[model samples]
Structures are given as C-alpha cells and as structure tokens.
Target: MNNIATPEQVTATALLLVGYAAVILFFVVRGALRIKSMADYAVGSVRFSPIAVGLSLAASMTSAATFIINPGFIALYGLSGMLSFGVVMPLASMISLVVFTKGFRKHGQTVKALTLAQWIGSRFQSTGLTRYFGWLSLLLITFIVLICVGLTQVLSNALNAPPLPVLVGIVVFIFGYMMFGGANSMVYTNTIQALLKLVVAVVLLTSGYEHFSQGVHGFLAKLAAIDPALTHATNPQSYLFRDYFEIIFCQIVIGVAIVCQPHLITKSLLLDNERDVNRYLLTAVLVLTVFFSVVFAGLYARLAFPGLQLNGQELKMDKIMSAYVVREFPVYVGLLVIMGLISAGISTLESLIQSLSSTITSDIIKPLLSPTVFSGTGGFRREIWLNRLVITVLGAVAIWLSYDQLLNAKLSVAIFAQNGVYAYFAAAFVPISFGIFLRDAPRLAVTVASVTALLVHFGVYYGRLTPYMQLPVRNPGVSAALGIVAAVVVGGVLYLALHRASVPEKTVAVAA
Candidate 1:
C-alpha cells in the first residue's frame, strides 16, 4: 500500500484513459453534426428517452466532488460526515428536484429558455436581470476548476505524473470537444459515465464490507479505537461537522436549494414530454441514492489507514481516496476504478462547459454585442462560433484557477467550489422558487433577493461572521443557508407588499 505506482500500473492506466477519451471524442464528433444552432447545442435537437436523460442527470449531479473529494471528508471525520453528505443532503436535494422540476420545465419550455439566466430573465420579464445573472454565472467557473483539479488528482496519482501537465491536458481535451458537442454528446457521454460510476460506486461501497465483520457496533469500535471522535455523531473537532446545526440543518437547507443550479435544474428541459418526467425523476433518484452512499467508503478508507499516513507522509484531505484506491485495489480493479473516477469527473465537467458557455454567449455577449456586432450575413453561424470561442476562454480560465487551487487550497478544492457554487444557488433559490410558486413576482423583489444572497454569502464567509466560520475548517454551507433565508425573507416581504398595492389598484380600475 505504501509503495508508489509501478511503471506497469502507470502505463496501463494511461492506455485505458486514452481509449476512454477517444470514445468520448467519437460521440462528440457525431453530436457536433447535429448541432447547427445554439439551441441545439444548449438542449440537443434529438428527442431522447427519459431514461437516458435521467442517467445524464444522475451523472451530472454526482461529479468528482461526490465520487472523489467527498470520500476524503468521510475518511477524515467518520460518522458525522456520512450523515451530512450521504443522508441529509441527498434526501433534501432529491425532494427539491422532484418538487421543482415539473414547474420549472413547464415554464422553461414555454419560454424557450436555454440557460438559467434566460429562464430567470423571461420569468421576471427583464432583460437586464437576465444579463446580471449571466455575469453571475461566471462564478460557476470555480466549479469547473474544482472538477479539473479532482480529475487531475486521480489521473496524476494513477499515471504517476505531475499534476500541472495533467491539469492542462484535461482542460484542453474536454473543453476542446465541448465547444462543438454541447448537450447532445454530453448526455450520451454522461449516460456511459453514469453506468461506469454505478459499478464503481458498488465496488467502493462493498469494498468496506469486511470492516463490519463483527457487525455495526464492532465497526464503530474500530473507529473509536483509532480516534474516539471519528465514531461521534458530530465531530466537534471538524469544521464542517462541528454540531447538529452545521452537520444536518445547514446541509439540508443547502441541499434543497442546490438543484436550482443551471446544470442540475435545466436537466428536466431535455425531456420532450410531460409523461417522461416521472420516469426521469425515478431513474435519477434511484441511481443517485446509490452514488451518495459511496461516501461511506470513506469510513472504510479510514479503517485502512488508521493514522491517515502513506509512505511516511501525512495524507491530504483530498488525496485520501486516491491513495486508498492505489493501496487497496489490485491492478486491474484499480484501473477500472480509475477510469470510473475519470468518467465521474468528465461527465460533470462537460455539463458545466455546455451550460456556462451557453450562458455567456447567449445571455451575456449576445445581448450586449449581438445587435451591433452580429449584423452580418452569417450572424447566426457567427453566434455559434462565438460560443466555441467562449468555451476556449473558459478553458484557459479553468486551467489558471485550477493551478492556483492545486497549490493553495485551504483543505480541499471542494471548499473553494462550495463557496462559489453555494453563493450562486443561494441567490438563484429565491428567484427560481418565487418564479415557480408565486404568480406575478415583482422584479424589484427578485432583484433585491438575488443581491441580498450574494452579499450575505460573501460577507459571512470573508467577514468570518459566524462561530462556525471562525473555525480552522469553515463550512460554506452555513453561510449559504443564511443567505438563502435572508433572500426568502426580504423577497417575500417585498413581493407581498407590491402584490397588495397592485391588487387594490386593479380592483378600482375594474369598478371604474
């Protein structure tokens, strides 16, 4: 387990991954032909089965963060991490997905919206608001950086290569193809990735079965023997799982709103009919249930490395899972898992590139510069080319940020991503919620809510406003939850007041 990867191991992993990348490129090429317009690239022109879309959703939702980075948290702090990530968060997110999907899709489909910003803009009847959201969507590049770093970690570890080259290569390859493929190839690649992930998830989860040979209590005893805090329901020593509030309450609230993200929520729009909704939700929820459970593999990882050290060096919070795979699995099994991990990272990365690039091109650049610049014979074609150019720029940004995060991450890149991602979804939660449930939502209220979320989230985190934030390992979830609460409260009050005023005016006008 302590030995470094052999030459044979490195070569085999590289070959398998190259083959995987080739297959993905093939799909991208096929899908590129079908993508003539930006709309097709945004949501795919073909009518796909609900099952395939569902699997794509599952894949996109459970990314490198779920399969790679999260297990490291569980390995560090045992039961508390499991409860928060494996149970509470997933439960809330799935329920939120089911509750929000039908409403969002109905509205999104009706409006012909391709991006979350476009959907928000249409819902509020404000082009300016949509433009603002388009700018805000740039925050998601942080998440793309996260996946890049996670993938780099897995590939670097497996291939025994330096991380920088791997990081550059990954960004170039994935984002390169993504410029043309978009949603059509994205869904196809994601379905295959999801199936691979399903097998790997099973393997990681079951790999730890031997740890429970003497049953649940015995398993707990082993953790307790190493570090008593590991078996605790709430790990007071850990920043994220300090108390019930941080572990359960904050995570659940964040989870409920997490589906509001562009990549996650807009997924339902890929389906062509209302009848397919139920099957899509069913497939997604069922597959994700198993995927989330893979966090429990961290507990097994902890059991394997009692001191959390390898080769006489302290294991990093992010590298524990990679080390575990190398130390635990045999060569062939390790290769399979490595491919799955690569798939896991790439699946979500593709979605992010598609969603973010479309948002930037359609919502931001098109609105700002299209009338002035795109006034030529091949304007429509130019717009499509513009989207590709945007993807290339995004790739460069991802490489830069990912390199910085690789060198200067606090605990893991997960935290960096969560801070940016949580702020985004927190702001999005209020508008999307009101847009779906409340009729005639005042634009002012939605604007106020969105601004409030961004301010509160960044303020709490950077200001170190909370007791939790004061800890060495801060939880972004707490700040984001507070931001969402503030947005709901402020936006709700404003909406109600505006609605009341308008109601009386309409009544008087009718009487006249």
Candidate 2:
C-alpha cells in the first residue's frame, strides 16, 4: 500500500545520485576558484555563452514545481490543472520573459547592479526603497522552502529514506557548497542540469503515449471513466481550478509579472554582450516550453492510479509523481528521472541561495553594519567572507522553514510557496515596470506603488476580501494579480499628477 521503491531500485537510484553529486561537486569546485571577491560571487567572472545562460534560465525558472510538485497538482485536479498550469501560465510567462528581459538587463548592465534591490535603488535613486526591498527579499525564503520540500519528497520516495534525515542531508550538502560557489558555479551547474532535464522531459511526456492509442477522445474517455471532472476544463469541486478566472486570467497576470523576480530577471545580466540577448531569450523560451509541458505527466499518473491509491494506501498530492516514477519506469529510466527532478530542484535552490544571500549581505547587512563593505575598487575579500556567513544563516533559516512546510503543508507546499513568492513579485512588479518603461517616474510614485502592492496582496489574502479567497482553498495568484493591477493604476495616476505639477516650477525658476 505504501508508495515505496524496491531495494534494487533504491540502490540504483542512490548510486546514480552519488555519481551525480560527484560530477556536480567537481564543477562547483572549479567555479569556486573564480570567486575572488563579492562581485565575482554575485554575478560570476567567466564570460558564459548566450546558449548556456539561456539553458540556465530555463533550468532555474522551471524548478521542482514544474517537474515534481506541479505534476502532483495535475494528478489531483485533472484537466483544469493542466489548462491552468501547462497552457495558460506558460504562454504568459514566456512572453513576459522575452518582453521584460531586454529592458531590465539594459539598465542592470549599465548600472552594474548585482541584485534586484540594487536595480530598483539605482533606477529610482532611493536608498530607503532599496533597503526596504532587501528586507522584503525574505519572502523568497518561502520559495526556498518549497524547493527543499520538493527535493525531499522526490528523494525520500525514491531512496526509501526517512524525511528528516534526507531533509537534513539535502540542506547541508546544497547550502554548504552554495556558500563557496555563487553565480559562476550556479550557471555551470544549471546548464548541465537543463540538458539532463530535457532528456527526462521527453521521457516523461512520451511515457503516457500508450494511453492515447484509442486517440485523443479515447484518452478523454479513460479519464472521464475515473472521474467526470477529470475531463472538464473547469473543476467546480476543486479549489484552485473552480472557474475561468482562477485558471486563466489570474495565471496570465501573475505570469506577466513573474519576471520581476531577481533570479529570473538578473539572468539576462549574466550575458556580456547585448547582441546575444536574442539568442539567450530564444533558447530559454524554447527549452522552457518543454519543461512546462512536463506537467502533463500528471495526467498519466492519474490514469495509472484511477482510484488514487496503491493497495490501500492513499497517495499524497506531493508524492504522486515520485510514486508514479517508481512504479512505472524501469530501474535505469527511473533513476534518470530522479536525477532530473533533483537537478530541477537544486538548480533553482542554488540561484535562490546565491541571489538572496547576496541581497542580504550586499544590500541589507553591509549598509547597516558597515558602509565600507565592498570598499575601494574591488578589494572585497572581506565581503566575500561576509557573503559566506550570510549563506550560512540563510541555510539555517531554509532548514527551519523546510521542516515546517514538510510537516504542516496544506494539500501541498506549493500553496505556501505561491503565497510568499507571488506577494514578492507583486510588490516588485510596479517598481520594476516603472523603472523600465517610465523614464520620469518619481521615487514617490514607485515607492508608493511597491508599498501598496504589498499591502493589497497580503490584505486580500489574509482578510479573505475577495470571493476567490473566501473559499476553503484560496488562490494566491488572484490576490497577486489584483495587487499588481491596483499598483499600476495608483502609481500611474500619482506619477502623472506629480510630473504635471513639477514642470511649472522648473519653467518659473528658469524665467526668473
């Protein structure tokens, strides 16, 4: 009844994972040698190719959620989950990435900004706002927890390891190495991970092909036989995909602004030349299309377990895909899939640790503790050491949060992650948009917009102000979308009014 791996399969997966770790460690150590200062640690010293950066972007953006947790959602909610996650979200996010990357990177590279907070502060010329965002960056720790839980789920299910020990081992190994290697190592590892993920994506997407032997309609019939809602575009009984608004509109809005995050946007800054931007975006969008499609594998899992049980044991949403992989694939193929899932989780985890630690060390801690953190020129050996200390603290925090989410997740850890992650990008959306497009945006306008987004997003969710949120299951994406819309409207009006009033003062002073 239990979802478990056989001893032979577990041994094979563990051995492959160990080999994978050795290969990753080799690359991490190689990249760590390049890290002589905080700058190098933050953005890397090596001149990486556009294709590699693009692959890294794909890998980082499509994390354990796409490969692991999302499938669980699809398995649980059926057709509605697929439409929302696989179709609506991917279309919006890819377009947003292509649209936002050039403008953000142009400004980021011009100012030599290392973090998202730095980009905002430099763009708007507001130290207070930058510091505020640096503190707000703590919300992203929730996402780190999601990835940690996801990695734990995949490993525990595959290796037959207890959750606590597996969780501790994962935290220590990943966080310990992350302290030494930053962006330089992250890009290298992520690129390799992306390549492996591509292979697994094909394997997973095709694994369900047999179910379609009776044609598309037949496959639908099979799903409908299990549960009629499984074939419907809208599952009224489910919390997440109950209506068109939750499935499509909310996802589209959130997707458009999702690029505002540091890990996703700052990826463009890694490229040395502007000409390579097109190639980078092209490669990323193409690869991500495949990565996103991997969510459909959940439908296959559902078909495999029509009753959602093995013997008499019920399958948890988060463990569905892990259990599916172990039950369906051959030992070698399952091991490859497990490695791919691990790669998917660790790729983004590395980026989070890199960006968040740098944000804490460079923007928050240094400003508060000592003004001369990076000092004259680039003699930042002290800053480099400080960054390692920051990573240690972040690692500890990640462990604490991950443990809590694993034990007390509501349905799945994705909700907890989405609540925090969505709120962050919602707050960031207004300022980043204004900074990129509105040349004359006053600091007051951007600052108010950012603050308003934070208030509106959290207010709607916690207060259950919106109808969508009042339900037993609430969608954080709805709150984020509404907050983004509110911010744009309020901030736009304020900027226009402020700009109109300030113009006359300049003219009067010149005439006098």
In the range 325-412, model 1's lDDT, one tens digit per residue, is 8778989999998888888899999999999999999988887773856666777689889998999899999999999998899999
Worst 10 residues of 2 by lDDT: 370-379
Q: How far is candidate 2 from the true structure (C-alpha RMSD, Å)?
A: 1.5
Residue 434 error for model 1, in Å?
A: 0.5
TM-score of each: 0.98, 0.98
lDDT against the true structure, each candidate: 0.91, 0.91
**Model 1 regions lying over 4 Å from their true place:** 1-3, 375-377
Task: Give the Cα error of residue 278 in candidate 1, in Å.
Answer: 0.6
Candidate 1 achieves a global lDDT of 0.91
Q: What is the TM-score (0 to 1) of candidate 1? A: 0.98
